[model samples]
Target: MGRALAGAVVAAAVAVATLTGCSLRIEEASCGGGEYPVLAVNSGGGDCVPDGEEPAQGWARYPEGKVPEKVGDEWDIYWSTHTLDENGEIIELPEGG
Candidate 1:
């Protein structure tokens, strides 16, 4: 009886840990009010614009191959020190980036 109870407790603990770990991953940021998010070109900045509205000056859509859909995702991290030029080429940010 003691061994069975210990085994059950261990199983429960493992299940809880697995569930907690799954929930701990960072989720994508949300843009409410029907607005979508955009990142600035040549800088580590971002904004949320109304749906169907174009990005404001200095702000642009992320490139096709490097769009960041989740907060702290791979592309999100990459864009921290990189940006697109007027010609849409990726370039390293200048000093103080």
Candidate 2:
């Protein structure tokens, strides 16, 4: 009886861990109003760099909220920005082209 109870407890623990253990990985985290869980800042809304006509050329923060220039080799950022602007235009950077 004790063995059966122990097995059941272990099974329950494993199930809980599987359901809540950082499984939902973000692909592109952006800073927007409609975004659900943005892990980084949105670089398109603010003032872009000089001589930059496109937002894609601007620098965006990583998923961990670190600037692209500040992040190190060990840092890995994942995010997916699918939202659009007021004109209903999907703003995508030039990279990944």
Candidate 3:
């Protein structure tokens, strides 16, 4: 009994350590009928942001209609509808958008 318990404890510890190396957050959004697409929020990715003098809010659209992309499986894209409008125009609501 003692040996079995020790083995179980060691197995649990190893499992936890192996899983601790990565983050497992569940983002709240769906794109292309799947979880949120991976977006470079405020140029936070390790890669350098493109040359742009001003910051603008825009969603990262998929290249095509592919659903099982990296963004859906691995990363998540997040956005808020309240993003500022530049033109100050009354935009009509998009149907089922």
Candidate 4:
């Protein structure tokens, strides 16, 4: 029957491309007072202290709603004026650590 309907449409197009081609990769987490300025999403990577500096310990990934807390798995410290929000924009916090 038409090769079983073309093998069920190629197995439903490879299961919808593996569930929408997956997405969640944000590495680089290690701050000791050098090379700051980072912003990863998906749940990993952070360190963008841009408000006078002097706050770069480790962990930081805010870009989904200005996450103030609830970030574990990594995050020693990160200010950046509380992850920006008050006209400077760049808020949507919430990923992981």
Candidate 5:
């Protein structure tokens, strides 16, 4: 019974971690013309920033459509609305911000 309880606790911890694992850290960003305008940023343990300024860092690239949008002038990334800032660093919003 003790072993089973421990296992359940561990499983719960894993589940919680997985639920909050996805995180987006926008270091630099910009939007413009093109079929798939790129938003330079470091996301999901990868660097998607444009320019060869820092190749040593692994940046991931995402289409403009996939990028999140900001809520008004605030730095909140509204994933639900599918809107995000086109330039500058990204800011994280609270649970309901």
Candidate 6:
């Protein structure tokens, strides 16, 4: 009886671990249908705009080489403290950035 109980407990533990592991997919942040994301040029702000619409005033498309594909991704992190000047040059943000 003791051996059987211990075997059952081990099986249950394995089942629990398998179930949890199967559900551990990392979901990516997304912009839902018909919209795309853009970042504010000189600030830590962003938005999702419709596919046919342009970024609003004070905001701009991320530069070709540095566009972020996911929230908190490498490019996204870099953009938080950097921006493009009017001439399209990359510049470090001011203090308190």
Instruction: Name the best candidate (by TM-score).
Output: 1
- What is the per-residue lDDT of model 6 for residues 1-97, given as tens digits with 9 covering 90 to 100? 9999999998888788798885434646646778777776766667788899998888777788777777778987888888876666788988775
Tens-place lDDT digits, model 4, residues 51-70: 45553343344444434332
Model 2 misplaced stretches (Cα beyond 4 Å): 22-97
| Model 3 score (lDDT) | 0.37
Clashing pairs in 3: none
Clashing pairs in 4: 46-60, 63-92, 63-93, 64-92, 64-93, 65-92, 65-93, 66-92, 66-93
Residue 82, candidate 3: C-alpha displacement in angstroms? 56
Candidate 3, residues 1-92, lDDT tens digits: the string is 99999999988877886788744456533433423343333222211123332223542322244322333343222122111123432232
Candidate 4: give its CA RMSD in angstroms: 12.9
lDDT for model 5 comes to 0.39
lDDT of 4: 0.47
Sorted by lDDT (best first), the order is 1, 6, 4, 5, 2, 3
- Higher-scoring candidate on TM-score, 2 or 4: 2
Tens-digit per-residue lDDT, 1-97, candidate 2 = 9999999998888788788893433343222333222122332332223232223433332334332321222222222332233443445533552
Task: In model 6, state the lDDT of residue 29.
Answer: 63
Candidate that beats the other on TM-score, 4 or 6, i.e. the better one: 6
The 10-residue segment of model 4 with minimum total lDDT is: 67-76
Runs in model 4 lying further than 4 Å from the true structure: 1-30, 41-44, 47-88, 94-97
Q: What is the lDDT of residue 64 in candidate 2?
A: 41
lDDT of 4 at 15: 82
lDDT of 2 at 32: 31
The TM-score that candidate 5 achieves is: 0.23
